[model samples]
Target: MASRLFKRPWTRSNDGSEATTASRPETPDDDDFHDAEEAVLHPDAHEEGGLAFNNRELLESQRSAIYELIRDMGMKFLTGHINLINMSLPVKMFEPRSYLEKLTDVWVYPALLTKAASCTDPVERMRWTVTWFVAGLQHVFQSWRKPFNPLLGETYQASQPDGSTVQMEQISHHPPISAFQITGPGYLFVGHSQPEVTFRANAIKTTAKGMRMLHFADGTSIDIVYPAYYMRGILSGTPRGEMVGTARFTDATHGLVCDVTFGKADGAAPSDRLLNRSDTCTATLCQLDRTNLASAQANSSASADASQERGWSKRLGGLTGRLTSLSLINRADNGLPEGSQVIGRGLGNWLSYFEWDHHRYWSIGESHATLWQPDPAALPSDCRFREDLVALRAGDVKQSQVLKEQLEVRQRQDAKLRKP
Candidate 1:
């Protein structure tokens, strides 16, 4: 027999008394959860992406045991012999939310988009957008625990009171891919992401490759590519996460490009080693000559001669910032002429208030605006109502484990049936 997906007990009291609608705790309305005044931020953002973890000490012990097992199977874990993706850890190691829901962490500070859209200056607008891009990565630095994998076709949709809505759907199952779209006042963000995970002896690396595009009402758009991440010290030492490599942001409309280089906070001796102490980045913005680009493209298509190529771009000011503290300063080449470009500087943290060019951009505590909240009236197909995830959220580890296995089995059976 098929099992019921959503089994929340909001309709009845524990004593079997019928609960009044007003007395009953809010079930999923599929909209914003609380008023700005009543909104509460989770203590550990990773552990409680939406729902709190059941037991802290027990989970930590479980994690230590798992780590020891992985350490013992050093070669097996390091090599492709052990596929971590297919390996299921205890439900205690997973956050209740699905990967689709976890993606919403980026929108915790959605006001950044509004600032970018409203800005008149093209350079300043890109800066705001870049700030938002960096802000969105905050969650990745918090934790590396596993999240529930959404079933194919499962969806999650929510809208803020301001009419800004975000929707995510699990589009693929084999190599799980999530498709997302965010529509707000003056901008539309759409992307399809597929996470690539690999485990090494020393670290576990994760990279999500996707086509992320942010479009504004003014016909300007930005193309984004994220950096690679690594969770180091898996076998021994204290485990920590680091964002490595260069993340690219190209504003093709304005002929502007920003390449952010992430490094360790300790500015230690520069080595080819991937391990970094903390999350720090330097973003260099450059302006491409549109006329030169057009000419170069035309020439390239007309003839394959390299001698006919032209200079394509010139360096603009850049932002040297720390992701943890949310402080960035204008960094320009010493050789560049002064007063040639309007360089801006920003300092302070994003948690309280982030001041850019002496103006506050984000003040989470003081601001009355509520962060993104899931709606109770979401579609029946939403992942929020998924049996396994719901059980996990309620701290029913055994039930969740069974449900998760059942769901996986059903998915496998469906795939087999579909195959000719």
Candidate 2:
């Protein structure tokens, strides 16, 4: 049978940017968006009291199957935390792409990094880096479906329209680590992530753990730390994906550090949810003194949000000399001395553009360039060659499940043999 549901079509504006909801004209895609409500629980699908994640609302039979599997797992699931590193998920729960490809989503707007690299001012460069970081996060919560995990030794290679090249390798299996390096004009971004996922009651949390470094040709480098992700209401209510916690961007070369706090998902307002602004974030940049360094490194999501609630005004007056909103940044006179003063602040949602010092940096709707597309000349061991993924893409559910199981069994046996 043909698929029953079709969400929005990928539409673009005349400027090549993804069309914003504000400017998009009525089209068949609107009907698709409505049809999607039956399969996916989006913001508009909420009931009177709150939103819910009903298995009946899902696309295929696999959602109910997975729900049953989890329910049967029951008390076993109650055990402290269930790690998904070794888990073989149902193929239907995955998008037909591999985790390696997902990593490249960070470079959707290659221009952001190029702008950062070309900047002469270290603080301005840091601002651009933070903007790039914020802009790239829009993809993480686009849907609840997970990307297929990369098999050990798997590799993916692609390039950008801007002449940048990207390469990713599934370097390890037991702990499941993937490494990638992207080379662009005047900058090199290399990082390895071992994503850790834990299952909690009615929710799952994931953290991308590892080292990420961006080196510019001018010898200026940035050290990045990513935030935590949460997919809530998996069992019954509305299935929602949110990004929480704080991400740090530090430029040691200039003694400047930026702390970006992704606020909790705002479910109270339907309007905010519809526009992808339900999850908002704010960023503050300050000089890296020993005291400031200690404080920045010690921030958790709770503490970070608590600090903001306690009053950024007081903090801006003293040691942490930076405003927390774009409006305040705009009011600051540009003639002020550089050091020991508030440079600029940023405020925006994680799923769209943000304003820095009252200037809008990048918009998710405005990014129309295709930076990375799958290269046809992939190696034999590439994720594109995975039998299960191939089967799924071909719409052979049973064969996909069987192939997935076989692959998982082989992986387990190989891992056991490698153990001391």
Candidate 3:
């Protein structure tokens, strides 16, 4: 069977931005508003000393007026077809359980809602849906940026059983500034702090023309460029752990490259220790571009929403689908090497709202560490052998004639023999 749902064609604006505003024209004047108010407040509006009838009458009047306005715009009634007015009315009447939940269910989650109702073309609908979802989410959540304290009442200075406090900041030239408590999946830390210091320096700014190198602050120097958003994720405790962050550095020509690396940070070492010493396990270098970042963020939001609604079966099927396509293309192009392992990491946890359940949290040791990799070679020779051994270790059986016979057979078997 074909898919039942579809996405609405997005209405694109002149400037290429997604257009989310309703197409319905506003009410002609204050006449409708005044009429509705009068209908509610009139003496006949009340019945049995209550204004229940009047309220209903007023609501009906308002609804009629809105419908009429929608009709005048050459569009169907506000409730006609799949317009914004129709989509929003149910949410207004019912009062969504949660704002985020409503957005997901009514707008973000339902791709078909837009596709089925949209007047625009499919390409436009896809583009507009993505833009609309991104803009709408940002508008709703960005304003609620109160400092989130995931670890309520958690102390920053945690004492281990040994009694030594985790040294958050070793000796640094920069004076310690503010500290905030943050908690992630596996680990919790009390006082996370960052210090900033400013030094006066001369710098040559980069332009489209060519490179201009400059220096200031005595020995301190930097090649000037547009500021970029920087992000870092760090894991640190008494025994060294992983830290990942974007770093800015220049080559011999003073061209800057932003390097993002994931690895362990040596707590014993100084703050300025070279990243290479800390086992630069994974690194990706992307040129600084705000537009690209914004686009990626938008796409990420859209994909995240879709991932949440997909069923387990569909998700698994999608994995096979992608693998088949890749295998075919790779074979034709001779792109991939022989015996290349397709290490597929499904976005299984993306369907969950809780960050702790996600792979990102698992990597950072936020919650319980989960086994991410399994070795097929580690399987026991016999399917029941591992379980039987475990059961024996758990005192399931003290002694058995069958177990003795199996051991004897194993000792004599050349295939099962191992060098001491």
Candidate 4:
């Protein structure tokens, strides 16, 4: 159905030759400047991507510093067995968020997909819906900090810009499960996810199992599932990760399904697998970087085939799938740059559409900083009420660690009381 529906429709002349179209350069209207103002320039253009000779050296040194961290990590992996929680890990590796906040990182982007959730056309909605899920692959190599596990019965809630709100609760401590539901005027989303944690010699693999069921105002429902994720270079090198599974979204009423493939198939040699080459982040970083760039192309036409794009729109076809292989969208099809024809029908700029930006590198930081209230609004039992969270966010690693262990101990005690 998608193959037939998403075929590029090209115009032809009387002679039957192919016709082409060009998008006018964006002309900003007064409302557009007032309206189109998305990112405020740092007041310096050259400072954006340009670099002086000395600055170039400094930047290279910075990357080299990060490169060294990878090498040192590899050396450490050569030592002893690292547990799933990495008890022996240097304190520097932990990013202070509770396990609950880390999972929220997974939910943030989906909330931005209200357009897809609210779409009336089932097919287009599925396309938008699944494409957005695949777009989550962008977070594959983000940061290496593993969040602390959430306590049983602990919960978190976030309201969306679309006037909708979603809540997640830690329903179990034994298997560590989180059940989330998004409710509002036009759509409803409910899902449960739990991870089976495993340790590879040089990496950590998380097999995430769950499905998010999206229901629309017209009774349309779509099931979205996320792919498995692995943290690479953890044991003996610079840590990174990538999305390595095939995710599917199936629409019940329409009998439609969209499958999105992310990351590369494992191609390590038998020896490479046994003796993890964690020293080099080269291969994984290369793949993740390319994936990231392609996703970035969706944000700016200048990064893509500019002649056809007129910026992302508010409609279904605006953000046409280009990066992650949209069985529903294409970039260069059959050796022909399907530029012009994909204009309005292409996948939208997911970043702008979902209002995601540089801060994604911070993951759940924005949610903790601005979205949730710490005092009166946050219950005494809320995670925001934890002093450890405050110390961690403030970069006080030692105090945060002390608080982390105390909280873990308390959780264990509470769990015992709940058992029959």
Candidate 5:
């Protein structure tokens, strides 16, 4: 039996509120709640590349805001490393034994900073960014007590004196300038350690102390010094330790404007053992700017042709040539010998000896042991030949005959004047 039952419809209040608002179970899927959370977490949720897409005006404003954020962040990250190294305690240690350990943790900052610059992952970037600044001061104590080997190659060996052999294995190709990045603004700290020595029979065995120069991103540089003396210790051990140098900032744009002097503690004292004290007066300017790579490439291509033309001009200008017979009769002062075989042996020697490219040396003997190194400074300055001098020195028969005829005219004038 079906029964008809009246059901009440949902009612709304007259206070202009949401009608029939469901008192649904509090679920996490509410649209208004989700939207509010998204707004709080990512305010630019609708933007692409951090720029608003709804309107041109909004996009312009977003772009400017984003750029400023990036610029401020980059500057802070870059300069933060410099400040951290400036205020470190291990850096203050003067003892040679503990120097290396003190600077061990210092490399973290630069390593992290370099990684941050290269990193693309946001998580890794954040980690490195934080690590870059927190890493404390770094002091690199270079031992002067250790023997330094100057590596030389075969080419260099052939040029140097006998018994002045260099240890080719020890030569390092790394430039000190690269370590500091002097091309940009930064600070550099250089440290010097005292010489350590050992007593050998009749000879004082000594190793020079080590010196290290630290370059910071900021312009400040610091230097530290350590004391080391070589004496027979209770045990036999090689004295190997580190030293520190001054700390100061240098402007990358202006470079070092003062003379930074470094010398041994004993003034002009010749000791194989390294000295302890040193001083610096900074004056030289170092600057780093963009190199014109394109212009340099262009110049390299035309350099060969330009060099050839210059060589031809120098050789031809030295040649002594005879004047045509027709001109000899017409012109009184032709400034040329009648007929002269240009003696260009000296010019040929000059050309043969001259090196267009000064980079390489010319082998002289068969074994090539003796090399004729070109000296551009030694080249003759008076390359142009005088016609009168050429006429007097002519050796060839045809050249002498032409010169005699020209000289006969001059002799006749002298004889006429003498007859009076």
Candidate 6:
């Protein structure tokens, strides 16, 4: 009767920040971390997960009717193990953001990381690199809907607001791989990602492979790998997502490995309404402090165990950035007009790993904005300029489905004609 998933919470309005108060406790020592947090989270069920979409105590009281309709239509059968390229789903389920735009969000990194390639200190380099990677993640998991499948050979490009530009090419059709390149004044990036999926009765897992590669003018280089993700709350529960797996940034040139594992989920009890943080991992990373991280990384055996297990927290619903603490919160609108909404750092369902405090560490914000602009005159193969693309991105489900199928059919017909 209730929904069950997020993988991401709407932390705030897209416009601004929220005000802070003395609601949070003074920082706790490593041993007192869990006990401290337990005292802080609201005890009321309705006040849970910190709402951002609405001012009400609970996040938009979801209706069981949607699930009923989906069941009446046998939606589950079509949901599993199908090639998304050929499958069709309602567009209302997806975020309007495209994967290309998603890429640009993270590409804001090169600017933050240009100095990464030039720094001699491994820790400093890893620090900057990790920040770049994490910044792009704020909005990645906000919805359960999938992006419109870029037709085979469909491409996309962006000329950022900053002086940078990025290009992406959908290289394969069957397995669906996308390759991209970004060039700017001080940096260059080249990477490709291929997705492998596993569909479970109650969840869908999407694994993105081939870490990004970035180069600085000084010949410094590194490769980045994304954390694996899962769409949960399928069928009978709320739909949401969780960023699992260890994201890695390996600087072969600098002999450094920065691995960040999103921590475990924490609900009030063993059988709480929440159904997130997979069942595979054992350690609860929600409360890891810098001392604990340093202790873990300094101990050769613990570091090895971390690498071998590659598994961090399975609860707490926050992330443990290898050597840092990160606290995330979004602004909540107290039923105010959009213009009247007060902004601050705390509201919504915040995800913090305690590794990032504005005064503590990893706090250089806004260093990753891009300079280029979106180019309107994209080539025929570009996804942005594809016919009907605007409608697809605008969430017009029926129109997008028709266009998707038409393009696929056209490609097949042309292939048949090419057969000699």
Q: Output the number of the lDDT-best candidate.
A: 2
Question: What is the alpha-carbon lDDT of model 1 when measured against the actual structure?
Answer: 0.58
How would you encode candidate 5's per-residue C-alpha lDDT over 1-420 as one tens digit per residue? 121121111122334332332432344765432111110111111111110123344334433543453375564432332211112111111122121222222332343444544554433332333233222211121222211111111011111111111111111111100010111112223332232333332112333233333233532221122222222211222221111222221221222111112223333334211122121011111221224223323443355346446453232222211111111111112221223222111000000110111111110110112121212332121111222223334534345345435544554575477565
Candidate 5 worst ten-residue window by lDDT:
346-355
RMSD of 1: 16.4
| Candidate 3 Cα errors over 4 Å, as ranges | 1-278, 285-322, 325-389, 392-420
lDDT of 6 by residue, 215-238 (tens): 777666656667766655544434
Expressed as tens digits, the lDDT of each residue in 280-344 for candidate 2 is 67777877555544433444334435646856334223312322221111111222113434556
lDDT per residue for candidate 1 within 136-157, as digits (tens), equals 6655644456788889888899
Cα lDDT of model 3 by residue, 1-420, tens digit: 111111112223445455433542344673322111110111221111111122344345434544454556443332233222112121112221212111122112222222312423322222222222222211121111111111111112222222222211111111211222212222222222222211111111111111112221122112211111111110111111112232222211111122222233233234322212322222122232444334434553555355446432232232121101111111111222233232211110111101111112111111221111112332233112333233444544433224434543553473344335
lDDT against the true structure, per candidate, is: 0.58, 0.65, 0.23, 0.44, 0.24, 0.46
Q: Candidate 2: minimum summed lDDT over ten consecutive residues — where?
A: 326-335
- How far residue 347's Cα lies from its native spot in candidate 2, in Å, is 0.9
Estimate TM-scores for all models: 0.67, 0.71, 0.16, 0.55, 0.16, 0.58
Tell how far residue 27 is off in model 2, in angstroms: 30
Q: Where is model 6 poorest over a 10-residue stretch in terms of lDDT?
A: 325-334
Local error of candidate 4 at residue 111 (angstroms): 8.0
Off by over 4 Å in 6: 1-86, 90-98, 109-111, 115-120, 264-359, 363-373, 393-397, 415-420
Name the TM-score of candidate 1: 0.67
TM-score of 3: 0.16
Best by TM-score: 2
Clashing pairs in 1: 28-376, 29-375, 29-376, 29-377, 30-375, 30-376, 30-377, 31-375, 31-376
